[model samples]
Target: MAPAPRAQPSPVAVAADVSSAPVSTGCGNGGPTTHRGLAAATAASRTMYWPLLRNAECRHGLPAGLLDALVFQESRYRPLVVSRAGAGGLAQLMPRTAGDLGVINRFDAVANLDGGARYLRSMLDRYRSVPLALAAYNAGRGAVDRWGGLPLNRETPDYVRKVLTFFNEDA
Candidate 1:
């Protein structure tokens, strides 16, 4: 006799009302409690365009998870995100760097990611250390070389640690 076919599991159902709760107005009457849901939705949308992790991994030998971590640290995966220093896109490529990397459209998801990854790879090869490479990526290669290694700045140190931690966690 032939074995019986296995039944497919049914999809889980979520409560619609759960996402439509009342928000705290801080006055008296509550507003809409969709802040968490909205934030999550926004984040998911941002991740869709996070090309550094996806495109770089596909074309430039960069790790997707590392790219994701970098994007998280740089812009929290926000494609429209621009730094105070004028860096833009998911990977936060500076205008000059983006131009040098041949990123014609810095806002284009794929272009930005590829450019950032290539730049990162070049820095890594030059530094021969992930920490130093990341420091260079953040602070600049001249600064890294000037210090004879990674700088002793609190922000750079924390940034390196955070990226490494994210990398390790994802790995």
Candidate 2:
């Protein structure tokens, strides 16, 4: 009888094995190194403008991470983005809403974030829940009030879910 043929590794298997291996940073100065440190550094770098975020949070008594997550979800932290509906900046505030929030410069990153955070906090207070506040934030407070909290619309429900998911994950 012929000897059994040896099994050959599949390309997918080989690729997966290689990908499972730890990547080397190749930093010659290696004073200290850790995956946790690298992850922390990456997260920190993403929030290098944290002082501005913190200021907004402090001024409005809202959680900084929540504000950051909302801004990221709304505009990906872009200070100059405008929605077709006339929402502007990092928090995507409407011009009238920005005026109501006393945001002097709706296009300014700090001012926009501050106004958005304050507005969200007020909505939270009004609705008494994050999900409801998120729904109001996405859909309008009138819609939420009409529904006695979160709107019954599918789009608003999904938007609230996404915002809360991001907020929880980031926190």
Candidate 3:
């Protein structure tokens, strides 16, 4: 007899884990609830991600807050997350991209932070602006290059806005 096939998880289920699975804050409100399909950047998460982020910043020539905000937007400091689009871990790195960055294990905090910071830094250096860099990070470089700036895609603008708000660049 042939082995039975396992059912694949629905996108909705994967997305719930990606954006809404609460990390233990050990505080009130159970680690802050997700609002608008994005996790809240709680103080607990900042404390957790700070050490790895700081080290990535120093080694990658990126600012700590920039990486933090991106992580806040990407995974909310959740290490085991896997996105509906198949991106994985804290940085939401796709497997191929992670491999290219020498990130053999996306769930590994230090490796993910370093790879993510390096990727973000390269995007920033290439685009020379926060919006463009963020758009590239979210929508890929080809999209930005074709659009000649931030693409008019629905999700990319909101993504940039969220990261900017967390980075305090929205002012």
What's every prediction's RMSD, in angstroms?
A: 19.2, 17.8, 13.2
Q: Tell me the deviation in Å of residue 40 in model 3.
A: 8.8
In terms of TM-score, which candidate is stronger, 1 or 3?
3
TM-score: model 2 vs. ground truth: 0.69
Per-candidate count of clashing residue pairs (backbone under 3 Å): 2, 0, 0
lDDT of 3 at 95: 90
lDDT of 2 by residue, 1-171 (tens): 875333233221122221222222221222221222235644443355456765676666664356766776677666788998899988899998999999989888878878998898888677555666776788888876666655656577666666655655643
**In candidate 3, what are the lDDT values of residues 1-171, reduced to their tens digit?**
765333233221122111221222322221122334443445566567677676776666654356777887898788888999988888889898899899999999889988998898788778666667777889998888776766666687778777866665411
Arrange candidates by TM-score, descending.
3, 1, 2
In candidate 3, what residue range of length 10 has the lowest lDDT sum? 12-21
Best by lDDT: 3
Best-performing candidate as measured by TM-score: 3
Score candidate 3 by lDDT.
0.68
Error of 2 at 162 (Å): 1.1
